[model samples]
Target: MRPPDFEARMRAGECFHDVRMLPAAWAVLRLDGHGFTRFTGRRYEKPFDAAFHDQMIAAAGRLLERFQGLYAYTESDEISILLPRGWDLFDRELEKAASLSASLAGSVFSIACGEPVQFDSRVWLGARDEDVVDYFRWRQADATRCALNGWSYWTLRKAGRNAAEATAALHGKPVGFKHDLLRAHGIYFNDLPLWQRRGTGLYWERFAKEGFDPIRGVAVSTIRRRLKVDRELPMKREYGLLVGRLMDGAGSGDSRRTA
Candidate 1:
C-alpha cells in the first residue's frame, strides 16, 4: 500500500472503539482522585482539612469553567460536574470527555496543592431531570455517611486506638452509635461544617459591571458571569430541588436567578 493508504487503514482501527453521548441526554462527569488516601495522609489532617477542601473547590471551579458545566459538586477528593443536554465538547466523544477532564482536574489540583496527584474520570448520562437530581442526592447521602465514619475513625485513633482497633470500633456500627461515639469525645457530628457532611457546590452567578460607553459617553452597566463557591448546601429533598432549579435555568442561560 502507498504511505497515504497505509495511514488511512491504521486510523480506522484507532477510531473503532470511540463512542459519543446522546445529544438529548444530560451528562455528569465524575472525577475521583486516585490513591488519595495515602496522598492526603501525608499532607493533610485526618478526618477533615480546610486547606484540602479549598483546593478541591478551586479545581472544581476550573473544571466547571472549562466544561461549561451547569453545576459542580466536590467532596472527599471527588468532583461531579453536571453538563447540560446540548453540551458538545470534543464533539461529545466519551473517550475524549473522560480523559481530558480527568487530566485537567489532576493538573489544576496538583498545582494548587504543590503535590502531584492523579484523577480518573467517568460519565453518567441521565435521560430526565429527575435522574440528575437523584444522582446528586445519592452522592450527598454518601458524603454524610463518609463524614460520620471518618470522624469516628480519626477520633478513636486520636484517643490512642490503633488502626485495626479504630476500624473495629466503627465496623458495622449504626449511625446512632457513630454519633454517640463522637459525642462522648465532645465532638458533635451535626455541629461540624456543612461542607464536611453535604459537600460543596459550585455554580455560576451574574453581576453588574459598570464601564464607560465610548459611543454614548455614559457609564453602562453590563451583566457578567462568575463562579460562586457554595460551602453551605441543603440536604436530601431540598438538594434535589436546588439541582432541578439549576438544570431548568441552565437552558435559558439564567443560572443567576437560582439562589
Candidate 2:
C-alpha cells in the first residue's frame, strides 16, 4: 500500500540508530531481575531460598544451551553470560542482543517458577580475555558484598525490626560492622555456603566417553564436553585464577582450526 519512496525513507530512518558490537571483542550479557524483591518475597523465603535458586539454575542452563555461551555466572537475582568474540547472533546488534537475552531469561524463569517475572539486560564488551576475567571477578566481589548485606539485613528483620529499621541500622556501617552485627546474632557470613557468597559459575568441560561402535565392531572413546556448574567457587585471588584458566582454555579452543 506504500509508495516505493516511502519504503526507502522508512528503511533509512530505521537503520540510522542501529549499532553493532565491535567484531573483535568478546561480549558479556548481564541480566538482572526487575522488581524481583517484591516478586520473590511474596512467593519464596527471605534472604536465600532454595526454590528460587533451583529456578535460576534451570533457567541458566536453558540459556547456556540455547545461546552456546562459553560461561554463565549467577548470583542473587543476576546472571552474566559470556559470548565468544566470533559470535554473530542477530548480527551482533546491541539492541537485539540485549533484548533477546532479557526476554529469554525472563521467559525461562517465569516458566520454571510458574510465575511471571522480568529481567533487564545490558551488554559488556571486552577487548581481551583478561578483561573478561576481571569483569567476573568484579561481579563475584559484588556477590560477596550483597550476600553479607542481605544476611545482615534479613537477620534484623526476622528479629522484629521493620524494613526502615533494618536499613537504618546498616546505614553507613562498614563491612566489619556488618560482620559483627551478624556475629552478634549467631550468624557468620564466612560460614555461609560458598554459592551464597561467591555465586555460581557454569562452563563447559571436556571429558572422555566410552561407547561401542556397532558398524566398526569396536569400542570407541570419544572426547565430549558438557556444562560444569560450580557452586563452591573459590574466593578472591583463587577465584581470579580459576576464571583465568577457563578464559585461557576458551582462547586456545577459539584459535584452533581443523582443516
Candidate 3:
C-alpha cells in the first residue's frame, strides 16, 4: 500500500525533510558530568587522583558493556551513547548506571578524604557523535580554565581579600577577592593543569552561554553553593530532569516527530 506517487517522488529526488534521516535503528545518546571531591583547601597534590579516575573509567565501561551495540564515547567527565531506536526506556538504564557510579565513587578515595562527589547525565536528540566530541573538547580546552580561575579567585578572597569593597571593580557584585589575592600568592589560572583549568572556566561560563553577563570573578561562596546544590543531592536528578524534559517535549504537539 505504498503511496502511488512515492516511487516517483523518490526518483525525482524529493525528501521528507531538509535533513537526511538515518535509518530507523540509530539514535543520539549521551551522559556528561563527573563525580569529584571538593578541593577547597590545600590543593590535593594532583588535581584528580589516579585511583578515582580509574574507578570512573571502570564504572563507565561497565555501563557501556551492558549497553552493547550502542555507539559510545567517554571524553573528559561525560559519557556519550548512541542507542538503538527501539530501546525506549534508556533513561531507566541511565539511572541504574548513575546510581551505581555514585555508590562506586563513595567507596573510592573521596569518602575517606572527607570530600563528597557529584555527577550529572544528559542525552540529546538528533545529535551526532562529533557534536558530543566537540562539546567535551571545548570543556577540556576552554571551560576547565574558567572553573579554575573562578575557584582560585574565590579561594584567595576567602583567605581575606577586600571582596565587598572591590565588588564593582571585579564584575558587578562581590565574589571573592581571589584574583587580587591569588596575584599576591603568585598563583595564576594558567599555571594549573590544562584540563583542570578548562573545568574551572567551563563551569563559570554556563551563565555567559545562556546570555547572562558574568559577575566579576566567580563568587567563591556562590560557586560553593552551586557546587553544593549539584553535589548534595544524589546524582541521578540531573539525568532525570533531562529525561523528563525529553519525554514532555516528545509528547507535546509542538515538537517535530521525525525520529
Model 2, 152-179: lDDT tens per residue?
9999999999999999999989999999
Q: Worst ten-residue run, lDDT, model 2?
A: 250-259
- Off-target runs (Cα >4 Å) in candidate 2 are 15-17, 250-259
TM accuracy, model 3: 0.37
lDDT of 1 by residue, 117-152 (tens): 999999999998999999999999999999999999
Compute each candidate's TM-score over C-alphas.
0.94, 0.92, 0.37
Each prediction's Cα RMSD?
3.0, 3.1, 21.7
Candidate order by decreasing TM-score: 1, 2, 3
CA lDDT, every model vs. true structure: 0.90, 0.84, 0.40
lDDT of 1 at 65: 89
lDDT minimum window of 10 residues, candidate 3: 200-209
Q: What lDDT, from 0 to 1, does candidate 3 have?
A: 0.40
The better-scoring model by TM-score among 1 and 3 is 1
Candidate 3 ranges with C-alpha deviation above 4 Å:
1-120, 162-169, 172-184, 199-259
Candidate 1 clashes between residue pairs 3 or more apart in a chain or in different chains: none
Q: Which residue pairs collide, candidate 2? A: none
